[model samples]
Every structure is written in C-alpha cells, then in structure tokens.
Target: MKILVLRFSSIGDIVLTTPVVRAIKQQVPGAEVHFATKPGYRSLLEANPYVDKAHYLNSSLRELVQELRVEQFDFIVDLHNNLRTSLIKLQLGVKSAAFDKLNWQKWLLVNLKINTLPQVHIVDRYLAAAAPLGVHNDGQGLDYFIPAEAEVSLTTLPAAFQQGYVAFAIGAQHATKRLPVERIIELCALLRQPVVLLGGPEDAANGQLVEAHFSNRDAEKSQSRILNACGQYSLNQSASLVRQAQFVISHDTGLMHIAAAFQKEIYSVWGNTVPAFGMYPYRTKYHILEVPGLECRPCSKIGYEKCPRGHFKCMRDIQFEPFFPAAPAAAAPASQNRVG
Candidate 1:
C-alpha cells in the first residue's frame, strides 16, 4: 500500500506525527510511506528513514496537489486535521482518516475553564487517525534524526561548556508562552552550572540579555558561564546541542519535544497554556511547572502577544525552587546517538 501522511508545519507538531509514520511502515505490509510538510521542515523528515518519500507544500496548493496526484496514494492519514488537510482529502478523492482536533473540548477548557479534554497526549490521538489501517503504537516514543554531519561538535562550543551544560530553549511562538526576560535571568541566577541558551534568530536578543546579565554580574566567576547560541546554528545543530546536554529546561516549544525524543529529562515551563492540552513531554521523564489555581489561567487555547488579563500571573507568579530542588550535575555526560 502507498500511504501519504499529512502534517503540514511546525517543528514540534510534525515531530509528534513520527509514531504514526513508523506504525504505517512497520505494520502495513508492503507499505510505502510518504510524508507532506512545509518546505522549511524538509530537514526534519529527510533524515527520517520510515518516510519513503516526502512532499513539501509549495507556493501553490493546487500545484502541490497535482504533484501528489502522480503518486496516487492508497490512503491518507491527516494528523494535522485542519481546513487545508480537509481540502486535500477532498481534492484527492481518496478514502482517508483524520485525527480529531477536539476543537470544542479545547474551547471549553480555554474559554470556560471547564475540564473536558482527554488526558491522552497528542501523539496517541494522532495515532488514532491510522486505526482503520491496523497501525498500533510500538511504545518506543517519538523519532528525530540528526545526520552525523549535522552534529554540533562539543569542541566548537565555548570552553566553559566543554565539560557539561544545561540546554535551555528560551523562545516560544508567542510572548505569553514564555517567561519574561527578568524571570529567566532570575532563574539562571540560581542554576550555578554551565548554560547554553537555545533559540532561533528571533530569540538572539533575549539570549544575549541573559548572557550579558551574567557576564557583568559575576565577571570573575566561571562557576556559572552562559553562552548565547541563538541564531548561531541550524535546527538540527540545535537538536545536536539538546542531545548532548545533561538535561534540558525549556519553555513550551519545539526543543522541549526534541529533548523528549532524546529521552533527556525535561523541565517544561508553562505560561497561559496548561498541560491538560496533552502537548506536554511524551514518553520521557519530565516535569511541569506552572502557577496553579489561578482563575485566569489558560486564557487562550493558543497564546497571545501579551497576557489577556494584563496581570500575566500565569507565568509571573510561578515558583521555581519547588520544581527544581538540587541543581543538575556539573559534569553529566552527553547522551549517545540513538537516531541516524
């Protein structure tokens, strides 16, 4: 069978679909699995072995559809169940199944503060899209591949981080999803270990702020050295850094899921979004930190440029010491590569 699995964009959401891809390939006899995603994420799937072919959405959806028509997939698995996928299923005219996004459940949770959503992680829900095809979760968790050539060499990082470091992903898609710069600086003040700040070019300034704050505060101390690596490397290179770290601390974002793929213990900080959405770290040792029992918590199903309530207490009032007791090891060895 020739199957086309669709999850169009985002680092973390696409990564979450890997289990469905693996199940389709392993369980379906003679299955040739193809994945469709945005072009920027080509790197994420190119290195993956289970996906036999990859189709990237181009400038025109019609053109992308035409390209897929040639492959004539036997079925469709829509993990990203949105309007775009709906249109694709309509155009392809194929027998297909899609994951239920539970939009109403999310709406009730976000707007009414009512708890109606399931506790299942999004990965398991994504897998449900393939149930008709007899695909089952192998319980191995998510998949991420870093080609050997793309690996970030430890020698290339600052000498201070050569021994060990905590990889902290400091950026999220929305401002409200991340801690304010002041809060981040406050947390780093207590870490007392080598720290590598991780993010894209957009986060470079904030990463610099964190690094500069420490650089001036403790000019002579090497006990806690901070390196601002935002915008310095590609996504896979950043994943390489995450793989090599002793553990990872991240705002709710893509790197957090990447850390889970590596099975690195993760400390996931929360803001307006809560863990009940089931996007938390999957099948890995993890902790969730958020300001609990606030009436204004989960103000949005997604996030906002600023807090809707103007107080931002969901993130501002969060406590760290209780979630993070002992500091991570000063020299914990890096994890060995499990994916090619």
Candidate 2:
C-alpha cells in the first residue's frame, strides 16, 4: 500500500509524527510511506529512514496538491488536521484518517479554566490517526535523525563546552512562553555546571545578555564557561548540541522535544501554557516547573507577545533551584554521535 502522511510545519510537531510513520512502515505489509511537510521542514523527514518519499508544500496549495495527485496514495494520515489538510483530503479523494486536535477541550481549559483534557499525550493522539491502518504505538518514544555530515563536531564548540555542559534553551515562540532575560540570567547563574545557551538568530540577543551577565559576575574567574550558541548553528547542528549535553533545561519549545528524542534529562519550564495540553516531554526523564494555583494561569491557548494581565506572575514567581537540582561530582564523557 502506498500511504501519504501529512504534518505541515514546526520542528516539534513534525518530530511528534515519526512514531506514526514508523508504525505504518513496520506493522503494515508492503507499505511505502510518503510524508508531506512544509518546504523548510523537508530536511527533518528527508533524513528519516521510515519516510520513503518527502514531498514539500510549495507556496501554492493547488501546486502541491497536483504533485500529490500524481503519486496517488492509497491512504492519507492527516496528523496536522487543519483546513489545509481537509482541503488536501477533499482534493485527493482517498481513504484517510486524521488526528483529533482536541480544539474544543483546549478552548474550555483556556477560557473557563475547566479541566476537560484527556490524560493522554499528544503523541498517543497522533498515533490514533493511524489506527485504521492497524498501527499501534511501539512505545519506543520520539525520533530525530541527523545525517553524519550535518553533525556538529566537538572542535566547532569552545573548549569549555567541549568537555561537558548543560544545554539551556533560552527562547520560545512567544515572550509569555519564556522567562524574562533577567530570570534566565539568574537561572544560568544558579546552575553549578558549565552552560551552553541554545536558541535561533532571533534569540541571539537574549543569549548574549545571559552570557554577558555571567561574564561580568565571574570576570575574576579564569576560563569563559558560558557559551552562547544562538544563531551560531543550524537547527540540526543545535540538535547535535542537545544530543551531547549531560542534560537540558528548556523553555516550552521545540528543543525540549528534541531533548526528549535523545532521552536526555529535561527540566521543562512552563509559563502561560500548562502541561494539561499533553505536549510535555514524551516517554523521557523530565520535570515540569510552573507556578501552581494561579487564577490567571493559561491565559491563552497559544501564547502572547506580553502577559495580558501585565503581572506575568506565572513566570516571574518561579524559582530556579527546583528546575536544576544539585548535580553529581564527576562529569561523564560527552557522546560523539548522540543524534539518532
């Protein structure tokens, strides 16, 4: 059977769909799996072994649809479950199953603060999309693949990080989703071990601020311990860093999921959003840190540029000690190729 799986964008969301791809390939007989994602995210699936073909979503949906029509897939698994996927299912006119996004449950929680969400993780929900195909969750957890050539070498990083470091993801898609710069600086300062701040080009400034704060505070010390890697590495390269770290401390973002793929110990900090959404670290060692019992918590289903309440107590009131507890005396050697 020739099967088409669709999850359009985002690093974490796309990564969450890997189990479904693998299940259809392994469990079903003679299944040729093709994955369709955004143009920018093609690399995420191209290197994946389970996906037989990787189709890109071009600027025009009509153009993309035409491309998929020629392939003539036997089944469509719509993990995205948005309007775009709906249109694709209509156009393709094929037997399909789609993930239930639980939009109504999320709305009730976000609006009325009512607890109606299921206890299941989003991965399990995603796997449900493939149930009609007789596929089940293999319980192996999430997967992220980095080609040998794309892996970041130890030499590329500073000598301080070359030995060992805790990967600290300092940026999120929204301000309300991440801690303020001052709080991040404090969090980094409290960490006992060497630190590597992770983010994209957009987060370079915040990474710099954290580095500078550490520099000024520890100027009398000998070596430069904090390494700001924001904008310095590609997404895969950053994943390579996360793969090698002893453990990861991250805001609610893509890297947090990437860390889970590596099975690294993750300390996930939550802000306006709560863990009830079921997007927390999947099948990995992790901890959730958020202010409990706040009436204004979960102000939005997604996040905002700034806190609507203006207080931002959900993030500001959080303490760092709970997130990064005391570490062991001796550091283990860093893994050469931790990326899978």
Q: Estimate the lDDT of model 1.
A: 0.88
Name model 2 segments beyond 4 Å from true: 328-340
Residue 27, model 2, lDDT: 97
Model 1 stretches astray by more than 4 angstroms: 222-224, 329-340
Q: Least accurate stretch of 10 residues (summed lDDT) in model 1?
A: 331-340
TM-score of each: 0.95, 0.95
The C-alpha RMSD of each candidate to the native structure, in angstroms, is 4.1, 4.3
Rate residue 267 of model 2 by lDDT.
Answer: 78
> Mind giving the per-residue lDDT tens digits that candidate 1 earns over 1-340?
9999999979999988988999999999999999998999998998999999999998999999999999998999998888898999899999899998999999998889999998788999999999999989899999999998999989998788998898999999999999999998987876867889999999999999999999998788764498999999899999999999988989889999999999988878999998889899888877777887889878887899998879999888987776544665332222311121
Which stretch of 10 consecutive residues in model 2 shows the poorest summed lDDT? 329-338
The digit string of per-residue lDDT tens for model 2 on 49-139 reads: 9999988888899999999999999999999999999999999999999989999999998889997999889999999989999999898
Q: After superposition, how far is residue 9 of candidate 1 from its true place, in Å?
A: 1.5
Per-model C-alpha lDDT, please? Answer: 0.88, 0.87
- Count of clashing residue pairs in every prediction: 0, 0
Top candidate, metric lDDT: 1
